[model samples]
Target: MTDDLLTRVDNGVGIATLNRPKALNSLNQPMVDALGEVLAGWASDDEIRAVVLDGAGERGLCAGGDVVAIRESALRDGVAAAKFWFDEYRLNAAIGGYPKPYVSLMDGIVMGGGVGVGAHGNVRVVTDTTKMAMPEVGIGFIPDVGGTYLLSRAPGGLGLHAGLTGSVFTGADAIALGFADHYVPHQRLTDFTAEIVAADVHTALSRYAVTPPASALAAAREWIDECYAAGSVTEIIAALRGHDAPGAQQAADVIETRSPIALSVTLEAVRRAAGLGSLAEVLVQEYRVSCASLRSHDLVEGIRAQLVDKDRNPKWSPATLAEVTPDAVSAYFAPADPDLTF
Candidate 1:
């Protein structure tokens, strides 16, 4: 509680450590506010030429948002919960568009909110321990925090598959999908950090980037693209079910367990984000989609099933992909007078 985000400077590099190791550095309202403040301060500071974000624990960089707090806040005062999400989204947008050389040493599990912060950085470093994903569908929430934008740009149908299935990927998949810029062994991070700390502010650090020896995921792109190219959630499910690979079955099981409504919305969100004009534009659209998600979707029930009750069977609103009406899905994209202007 005392230490959420720890800030320090080493040879002009401003390093922000997400310090809630017990929670895998999950983002809470206070942590989001703290990040916004720190980012705002660093935006104009010339001395802090680079920024490095890392997590404190062995398990990962950051896991996801603090769902317990979100649920509690919603139960207490719905307006407060809305405000918190709005502020958190703003912080995510700011980081996505931040001008400085922002780097993330994504050493372990990076998912949900973590991907928005780490993978969106200018220099995203993945390690052998890194396992990346945008798994909002698993918890009955559509991916937010500008994830729709990033997922939209991923090669082939990878975005659609990932958004709908809540599939976890290794550091290798991250690099193949363009989510991460470089891959290095976790063991080399300390030496790499020292090199970064020692370098002059004006010097470009691209030379120090370490890409791992070619990974097998790149070779499996054909299968990934072909199997995931289906436009609808049901089609993708059918395709996955037909595949004999262990990876395909694992992904299918995950899809089977998630909220139907959340998965549909996530697929739609990524597709919509892909057509947007800019990252900021996509983020604003995501904000609209997210605000609508709280009231119109099965997020509450999803959380209840998976977290509150510990019952994995979530009674999704629509129950199946076909039951989700086009009008109901379109409502999430409807414009507001005081629209989400990220």
Candidate 2:
């Protein structure tokens, strides 16, 4: 009902359009809660045969959570910031586990939270405009919102590479990496929308206006898999640094740019998430880690340096990757005594 999100029914389909175009549809608490409510309602509505999720503008589907809000929350009440992430993660799980046929019009910038919404769908439509990434490490957070599950399902060490490096993938690369199901021309969105409204999705999707060739991400598969398999983020960084390949060095740059603590915790979460039984299980485990992350050394510092001050010079605790301790890392997985139920 809020302008942040709009919902309506046309024929047998329920449509949810993200309306915050200026922020590239970045999710705030209101948007997250609203989306969760609408999705939950549609899940039980027998008249709603399917759902179409899209953003209002041409820029992208969604960027991710509003980190500026997170930064402000961190500045005000530290524990409340943790609660925000917890609630958002639960909403992500609800969308992923929704029983209805959720179709995502994954155009524009589909990263982090965007992927959480689109990737879980029964049908995911990707366009040339779609630029997909986890990129959570770049912002000093782990890729939550079922991202750990998608990363786990990625080919070989690609999950680790993409998760750690926060690299962007083109539509073709997205499909090859199993992040997207179909690709279509960016200009044909109107036709695509029309088909979904007509409730003849299968037939409408069969025709494509344009298709691009494979992307560079696919070509670097062997190197990504071999290099990313190292024991730790530091080890992975060393491995990439040691390689003579230019691509390895480039990958190393990304790893080096990220918050050492965020990278460390994210790798651990992804590894742990890979071992879980289902999407819900992965999210629950991630919730435990994230709750603890609020009190961890790097999160607030990371947010301060990146979003609040806009300096990008985060004074990460432990200072260097080598100084990160196992016990410190273990704290991220420990249950918060009050325990977050989601």
Candidate 3:
């Protein structure tokens, strides 16, 4: 529908390609709307048996959401930013609930909103070059886009470690952590997509899927579970610091650099999302936290430091984890106005 997203129907397969290669196919409101519209149309179309989603360009599938744009909107008019999240979350829900098989080729960088689109699909195909993360805390935000649901369900305490440190995941690591379903070689991806268009999705994917390399996350799971399973962020950090392993100490240091409030609230969100049964429910909870985060000084400051200023120095309110109060974290979970419902 828009140049940012190219859509077409090839035989019984509907293909959607993210076209903003220069931006690493980072999503904006227009791209989100076009994707939602195309998916909705194909959902009921008898001719379309399945859909394939991928990004154009050498870099990756998508970098993330248009954070610079969201930051600008948040500063000028909070309503615009809120609406963007509303629509984006709805699209995420649609992808999760789509009736037809949905194939997402996460060939490169898949983070934030990109993860929402690719990971939530029925068939998530990651390649050797694939690098995935939910690095929201670094930007003064919690992982949204139904990230809580996905991460919360990860094996052991791996999800908590991921959320806290914003660790990047390789294709093997993604599969090990349950974020991706299949691993296809990057060179074979185009051919694989063609096969899907010509034949069946499951059959084509199975034909191309290969066993990934040993996951680094799997090797570190014992330490991760031990460090992140603590009841609170302070305790988690203390555990990480007290751990004998170098990796655990490094992880502890990484968490120290992120926004304290974001880290605190994100921990609560992931823990709570673990109990939730549905993606829709997780989206609602995410919405509440996101809306509350908009009013926090850290969100805007985080965006400014990371994207705007590029100084990489964010002055977080409640500068230390201990400064983040229980009440302040609880407020992020309070119900949003006109609550997010399917």
Candidates' TM-scores?
A: 0.91, 0.94, 0.98
lDDT of 1 at 170: 83
lDDT of 1: 0.78
lDDT of each: 0.78, 0.82, 0.92
Model 3 lowest lDDT segment of ten: 72-81
Q: Please, what are the lDDT tens digits per residue for candidate 1 over residues 200-282?
A: 42233454556666755556666667778887778888888888777677777878788777887788888888889776787
Model 2 Cα shift for residue 192 (angstroms): 0.6
Model 3 has an lDDT value of: 0.92
Q: Per-residue CA lDDT of candidate 3, range 188-259, in tens?
A: 998899889878987787789999999998899989999898998889999999999999999999999999
RMSD of each: 2.4, 1.8, 0.9
Best by TM-score: 3
Name the regions of candidate 2 deviating beyond 4 angstroms. 209-212, 337-342
| Model with the higher TM-score, candidate 1 or 3 | 3
Whole-model lDDT for model 2 versus the true structure?
0.82
lDDT for 188 in candidate 2 is: 88
lDDT of 3 at 35: 97
Candidate 1 residue runs with Cα over 4 Å from true position: 200-208, 213-217, 243-246
